[model samples]
Target chain A: MELPAQTFQVTRADLVRYAGASGDFNPIHWSDRVATKVGLPGVIAHGMFTMALVGRAVTEWAGSPDAVVEYGVRFTRPVVVPDDDQGTEIEVTARVREVTEDGLTRLEVTATCLGEKVLSQARATIRTAR
Target chain B: MPLDPSFVGRTYPPTAPYQVGREKIREFASAIGATDPAHHDPEAARALGHPDVVAPPTFPVIVTMAASSQIIEDPALGVDYSRLVHGDQRFAYTRPVVAGDELVCTNTIEDVSTRGGHGFLTTRTDVSTVGGEPVVAVWARYVIRGEA
Candidate 1:
């Protein structure tokens, strides 16, 4: 079965809320001063936080979250989340790479940040509903 | 500074079983903005042949991170938490994690090394049920940024 692609935007408030909820009180995600001091151009989002959004995109596309059997991603660049009108948006494109005899579908996933690849070499295996 | 090589193969005690719950899965899915019905409704999951609402793939991070504390808090490891950053993450799954499955994680420090003026630490956490049925294995790599 061919699945459609999905897009998502991560707002500044989203990053703040995730930091609070995940107990990852890293200053780089919320404080500009600390971020700049740490050599980043500005406050950057957590890599795992961004990766989690990729998982969301896949699950939402498959119409079932439990369908995902395996998911892996490598963070290549930091998503500079600015506190402004232009929110950081992630566009995820997924296609059915292959389907196995056991009812598992391999999904090739790509997540881009502001037109640049933030996550590379991403893939997921999902067991389809019979 | 050389890390204790003996720590490489040491496997920590298994964490207490974490019962997968529907509410928690929904919370995680919502946090990531996953609007899939199979993550929030048991009926939808049952229709898809799952026992109950299942968690998103990355949901294993919650358990793996908890298990990683055993390595992070190891005083002999001499890890500086403040300077560490997540480098990479990968997961291999044998099956989907369904609600009501009691899961435990056994964490092992796979490797510790220093190269090009940076320290790299890799840990693998195996998640399984009480009956030894494997669910997923999470591999996490962290890099300690060099201080000026």
Candidate 2:
């Protein structure tokens, strides 16, 4: 039930594409002025978008998209995507908390934005193909 | 502008049932880059005791968001979709959502208020099977920023 640790990098372009595909055109996600006007420090990625990435990390580890049975997360902090050359990176590490008698594997997930936890108490239960 | 308190306890009609499909689950998982086998393989899901491939917990968003359209389109509710921003969301699950389940959602406006010049609205949606088995409850908050 041990899961491999995984990490991912999210760029402004990724945010833009996610916004388009998800039909969430909120300017704060892509426009600095709109972000600042909303009293945010700068552009922030969509929380759902980040959660989706976390979901991907887990599914990728399982080796197929359909292996997950349940997943949830709480947005603890905003992922402030800097407009600088460095952009932003999210590192996600997942460990198997338990494997139930029914074969449901519970995972404890941690996602960091520049080494600080952006999403906390993330977890998923996936029915493994095995 | 004050919201109608009468709407607070009102529950909307149940949305038409959405039949969960393997292809849609795979598409959603792939779009999010979830490579979990239980999300895609029925044999894998059955190995884990589920009747079929089960969806990731957050997958309920697909159904509940559609249910929210009822409130968004309510003229008396006064929701400005253009000005609205997703504030927050959380889910409590009674059971996992698996493929082939015909599910319906009932949405209720839990609360509405204006604070710090921002309009805040909270809605709760209950998702269940066509047979009336409860699956999950989703709570979402939306914020409408004040005009400059």
Candidate 3:
């Protein structure tokens, strides 16, 4: 079974806020100069920020804030956020891979930016809803 | 420089206990635009059976990042921070992290492999309560890029 895709919008401002809240003040995530210096296209979203959005999607789908038992992802590409009102969007979707007898549901997930996959081998396990 | 493969199976001493704070969790949730009440309100979280505001699933990265830095920055480990990129991340939780919990981490080098001049370093962080109750185990992989 497939879950509804969730889209998240990210902006330069969001990156700054996340940098403060997460304490990851990496220049690549905030300064275009640094990102470009590192050969990145531009300021890129932190990989953990993308993972957190995916986690939000999972918890929303599970109907419980505390339902996730496991979550994982491989960062294949960076989500570059431009310095503009219309920054970028991340679309996340998932498929039910398995539902175990022990009340766990495993989901295979994908996250994309600009129609390119940003995350791979993404998966999450949540407690089966009663 | 490629990380030392011999570091696999090596474990670091436990980190100092980290107190999971309600305001910190809220700040993180808000920063990510997560407005879920369970992540903010103790009453809302209690309604869901959690003792206090529940941390979003990826929040453990806050602790593990500091804890794992002990290994990634170890001079003997030979990890080049400037050339490293996150390759993978994972977390397995016994329960949602809540406010007022003091968590500690023990980091272990799970794998180190070199391919095509790129170095892959995998680390596992075992997180538990100061009282010794397990909470979460986090794994992170970093790729050390070779010079172009």
For TM-score, the strongest prediction is 3
What is the full ranking by TM-score, best candidate first? 3, 1, 2
Q: Is candidate 1 or candidate 2 better by lDDT?
A: 1
Give the per-residue lDDT of model 2 (tens digit) for A11-33: 67777866655556678899999
lDDT of 3 by residue, A17-113 (tens): 9999998999999999999998999999999999999899999999888999999999999999999999999999999999999999999999999
lDDT of 3 by residue, B26-141 (tens): 99999998888999999999998889999999999999998988998899988888988999999999988999899999999999999999999999999999999999999999
Question: Where is model 3 more than 4 Å wrong at Cα?
Answer: none
lDDT of 2 at A65: 51
TM-score, model 1 to reference: 0.88
TM-score (chain A only) for the predictions, listed in order:
0.91, 0.91, 0.98
Model 3: number of backbone collisions: 0
Q: B26-140, model 2: which lDDT tens digit per residue?
A: 6666556556688788998898788988777567787887789899789988877767777767676777788898999999989888878788888999999999999988888
Candidate 3 residue B48 Cα shift, in angstroms, is 1.5
**Residue range B1-148, candidate 1, lDDT tens digits:** 4456668878999999988777777877777777778888899888878889877788788778877988988899988888888888988888778789899999999998887767888899999998999999999988877665
Q: Estimate each model's TM-score.
A: 0.88, 0.72, 0.98
Q: Mark the regions of model 1 whose C-alpha exceeds 4 Å error after superposition.
A: A1-4, A61-63, A95-102
